[model samples]
Target: MSSSGTPTPWSYAFIRLLFRFVLKIFYGSIVVEGTHNIPKTGRPCIVCANHSNSLTDALLLVTSIPPKDRNMLRLTAKATQFGQRTFTSWLIESAGTVPIKRRKDYVEGSVDNTDIMQHLMEALELGDAICLFPEGMSRYHPTIAPLKTGVARLVSDVLTRNRNNPDFEISVLNCSVTYMHRQHFRSDVLVSFHPPMTFSPKTHPELLAPIDYNNIRLLTTQMHEQISSGTIDSPSWDLVRVAKLAARIYAPLGTRMSLGDHVRVVRAFLEAFKAAEDGPEVDGEHPEEDEKTPAETAELAQLRLDLRTYQDQLARWGIKDDRIRRQPLPRHTILSRIIVRLTWSLCLFSISFPGLMLWVPVFLTTFYAVHNFKKTGPIFDTWDEIAQYKLIYGLMSGLCVWFGSAVVTFPFTVVTFLLVPALMWMTLRWLEDAVSAFRAFSALVRLLLVGKPTLRAMHVRREDLHARVMRLAVETLRLPEDSEAYFARHGGKEKGRVRGPWESGSRYFSIKRRRKRDWNETLRLYDVVDYPKE
Candidate 1:
């Protein structure tokens, strides 16, 4: 097999058959819209969407397309997913899959996005249709997250390579997959496709290339509008109405809502449609930020206003977050895939109490919280960053507890009590980079179990998984850390500079500019978080 280990045509066919059976058994009345929008045939193009469920969406896409078009689909599955099964892993590589390390918190670690961009450009040059999810991962909220500029970069690179010849106009079809029960079983799964989106000038340099933050913003707005089409069917809810509703909802949320927040509202509105169509009765778990004590409510209110302002800017561009109801997907629901994770702090708090310790859970959740800006599959995104490692971080702390108890059992009980866990914590902190690869294997298995179809316990191999993670680390992250621009974030250089969410010190404007600044554009606000470092 080729080194990347993409699945072969036969393997993909098998995978498609297998998943089709699963969909038949579990997902009923699957409805796929916008079929007319798919080009009968075209140059290698991009597929972008917001991620909600798991890689099952990949199966849906592959299954829906004809075999002739199947080969044309060189899906960019996250390298972390390579270990579901030995054959499955092999199949992924044989499919001519490129092992891109998009988000660093992956099992194999982060990717060199720049290299991935280069690889993607070449794939497009071959007239291969490259499928990608702009959102990084499945989001918990009703809305989409802010996207990384990597997509813009990919679009830019492909067009740049074909600058001399613009005969092949790129076809980017935005598909919105809505589920009846995103967390339940035997639900309806509906996927809607949109007319292919093309850059304005039909050129790369001034139009598509020289990608900037605003370009990233514009792309996000259009995406918000596109995905919302099939998902949101409200006749009255034009871009204007949605914009106004979003403003009202966000008006009181407070000023801290980043551009990401505005994006999420649009994402949420779309998700609400998916939930309404596919989900059973998903009462959001997180308490309404809009409803809280006076001080807290005011804080949320201000954040809400900031989000509306962000949306308003896009509305001015006439970027429509409109709705065009088409047929919905089949009926089914998402199963409870939530492997509830506990943090180390909670563990410490639990063990500290006697009776409560007796009732504490024996096993902590092992899943990692990977955040992808915008994703295609429910789980896999074009780029992903680990938002919170509290899951695995707590796992490490548990080991520290057992090892700590044994290492100092003989003497100095107090010293063991005080120093062991702390020492263990500090020591393990250094291992974060080293153990990251292995941790990804554990995370992948969890994702497959909770997200992918097939409920029986999976026979996943760890060492094999670890090896792939290692390969991924070498191929996706270790190398690209030196290259990709997306990997580059502003780290504060001076003493007064504030720490960024990801870095030890993120740069933001001092409080001096707080009142006068435009929250969206000002350095005083709009701080970005990196995958891990943030």
Candidate 2:
């Protein structure tokens, strides 16, 4: 950081590239959208996102933005992070993080953020971008927690600063980051940047006063609405699980979806569930529409039951959902596929063997890191923490070991350091293929051991369940029954389109209640704002 407590340009660039490289190593794929929505450096910007994964969320947000603006992007972290005595804390400080104390992180009247607020204001005055998670804390959950008012408060303060200078503007970008499996190694991630939510003292005068509690509350509510729309917001993990299963079954056999498309389908299912439970009010006059409602409701209930049963059966046999085929493959075809997969894996393994040998120290460093994490008093607790520890420890320690060796073996130092990362990448690819091949081989063994009648019965049950799921989804989501048609209509070459039930302003799908009960009470016990009773 420079003397002004902002990240120097070169330091910021180096850190940004380092993060990008680590991300490439960690996640299998990273899909970023809406880069054009990022605000220019001339304006003060606030990049707010939903927090699900712990440290990686921040790393993803920083790397998703354009490189030119990254040097000016100052990330806001929790005060607790600043107080930590670790290498991560040192890096956070050097990266010019503005630390603010949360109410929950401290006892009442223990500490104040007066100084932090002043520092943030100073950074904004220079048109530096500020990024933070409005949820206040990172979590491992399905639904987004109720957002804290920090974002609104900060915007109000910035607006107050710009009251006298009408030319100055503030841009708030809601960049929601989603993960396929947050804890899994080599999972996919999607970072989407929504259009900037701009504010100016001249236009939004009501928000200019820092002490305007009403306006601040309204702004926070608006921010939550926008952020929620971009996330996979549901009531519970159970709902998320069911929705994902339903989406998978709804697709055609051998169909694969990109991360964005998968997120859209899952969220749509979640929203449909919410809408069905809410059961919109309808006049008693329309008998035909009324009769259709209960039949669809019954169909959904049956679908859920079948899905749960199938899930339990798969669990019993230690089989994955994706391994279930609608039609059993010919024996020769299955055997040939398995043979080809193992042959390819073996060839790649041979190629990566030498590189792995050269990076023995790095492997040893990672082993130690894992051992430390498994201790009784481990520093890391969650999956995100463990993954981050492995990455950080491996990079830092590997570099130190290589640098020390380079001094003694002076001639080939540059080539040695350069070769390590390439070797690491090659090893990663070989491991992925080897694991996939092993799974295929295991599935093949199961097929051979299990009798044909039992396997055929399972296949028949899956096809029936899939058909039911698609039929229900078509009625509720208002999409074509055929998977290809749905994809062609909404899944464009670029952005994945998601149409909400109410997007068309149609009341046809909204069913009248057969029974009266409050659905909002059934929601998860998170801090989310209450939904109105239908």
Candidate 3:
């Protein structure tokens, strides 16, 4: 196992490259934005993000960093991950993660954070960037959990030591990661970085004059707002669903929307609906700024009802909005595409046929193992853990099969072992392509079966809904349907400015931006009483 200290740059780069490949295989697409916001190499900084997935969040965040500066990352993991002397432990430790035992993860009186805090401080002093999930625990939720005080406290303590020295400073970068399907294989994810939040004597002289409880709270609130802006935070899953559907329906047919833009549209819907529900804040400073007229509020309500109706309509058909958005092609056109897709799948299958013969047993064993194990698998609190277990089990099962085969074919052992990973890669490609082709065929068949009149009716309804929503988004929210136009209007000359919906302290997001309520108390308003620990 490698030590937790920084590794050689080359080694770190190689590891990053390896994980990048692994992630690409696991996810359909990993879109990273705001690379420009990453702090310079050797800068003392803390990278913070909302945690929804368990280990996958960390892997995605770490690999998203530029290769040259990847060596500067020091990940923070749960202490339990390093408790066992196993490959999992070695892998995490080799990644240079410091282990922190959260109070909830152990007996109430058994956890200590002194060493963990020391390690993080030392890492920062050495100019290494430490990454942490301020929300503490990873779980499936519609919004960010209440942040723990660790990050705020750490920054205050570090600043206290530096005392009024402008030469020594620390930056905090907030990365927001969103998953299209957190547990599904080959789903998409987006990682967005916002401008770094810096705290130094030159920037904030008051914090150094004396950091107090209020200062810590202020820093924590700022961190919360920054991270929240970058992520998809909603009051409930119902709003999340409705918002996603509205965004989907609002898009033009066959338009390729970036994950960031899609997220912005969804946030627009969520904030608009939430604002109407929360009603006017009489005491709000900018009451007139965002106070929607009665007609507009009623229009929003009508839009919500229409969106829900459309959602149910799509659900009844058991199809995604994309299917509806895809402009109808001539029968011959779809048939031609189907044939091409099938032919491509056949070609890939033929190429991988030889490897499949050798790896079929391993694949079947893995399938059966996962199937049986899941029944008795350790109960997990998050959907990401299900994927995590599949990954671990698949790796272990494949290795065992390779070792056993090597032993059985003693003389050809070297060749057998060498071929394992290569064959596995070929099989993976074939399976993915074949499954994709089959899904396309199924969708095409369903399309063919549906009457053209029904499709036309659905299209008409979609178009009307799209027009109304886009108008409201443009006029009411000042968020245009066209992402480029919105960016141009807002002077987002640089990338990562799809945040217009939440910018300028819009009254709709007033509670989120101003954070008037205590963080914990606000969490209770969301009915999340069981606060997670870091």
Best-performing candidate as measured by TM-score: 2
lDDT by residue for model 3 over 1-534, one digit each (tens)?
A: 112334445545555666676677566557788999887766788999988878778878878998565465778898889968876676677776789888788875777788889888877877778999999988777779888878988887787777746687888998888876665555667799999988776666666636567887888888899888876787777777777776655553223355666667678778888877666667866648678777777778788888888877766655556667646667887788878877866776787687776666755765675567557633345444655554555556666876887888889999988877677665665555555555556566666677567777887888788788878777777775575454335522122233446653352223211211111111010112221222
Given candidate 3, what's the lDDT at residue 349? 70
> How many clashes in each candidate?
83, 0, 0
Per-residue C-alpha lDDT of model 2 across residues 24-126, encoded as one tens digit per residue? 6666667787899987665678889998777778888888888665456788777788868898897788777778787777876677888887887778777
Quote the positional error of residue 364 for candidate 2 in Å: 5.7
> What TM-score would candidate 1 get against the native?
0.42
RMSD of candidate 1 to true structure, Å = 24.8
Question: How well does candidate 2 score on lDDT at residue 159?
Answer: 84
Q: Distance from true position, residue 157, model 3, in Å?
A: 0.7
Positional deviation of residue 147's Cα in model 2 after best superposition, in angstroms:
0.4
lDDT, candidate 1, equals 0.44
TM-score of each: 0.42, 0.81, 0.78
Stretches of candidate 3 off by over 4 Å are: 1-17, 322-380, 398-433, 448-450, 481-534
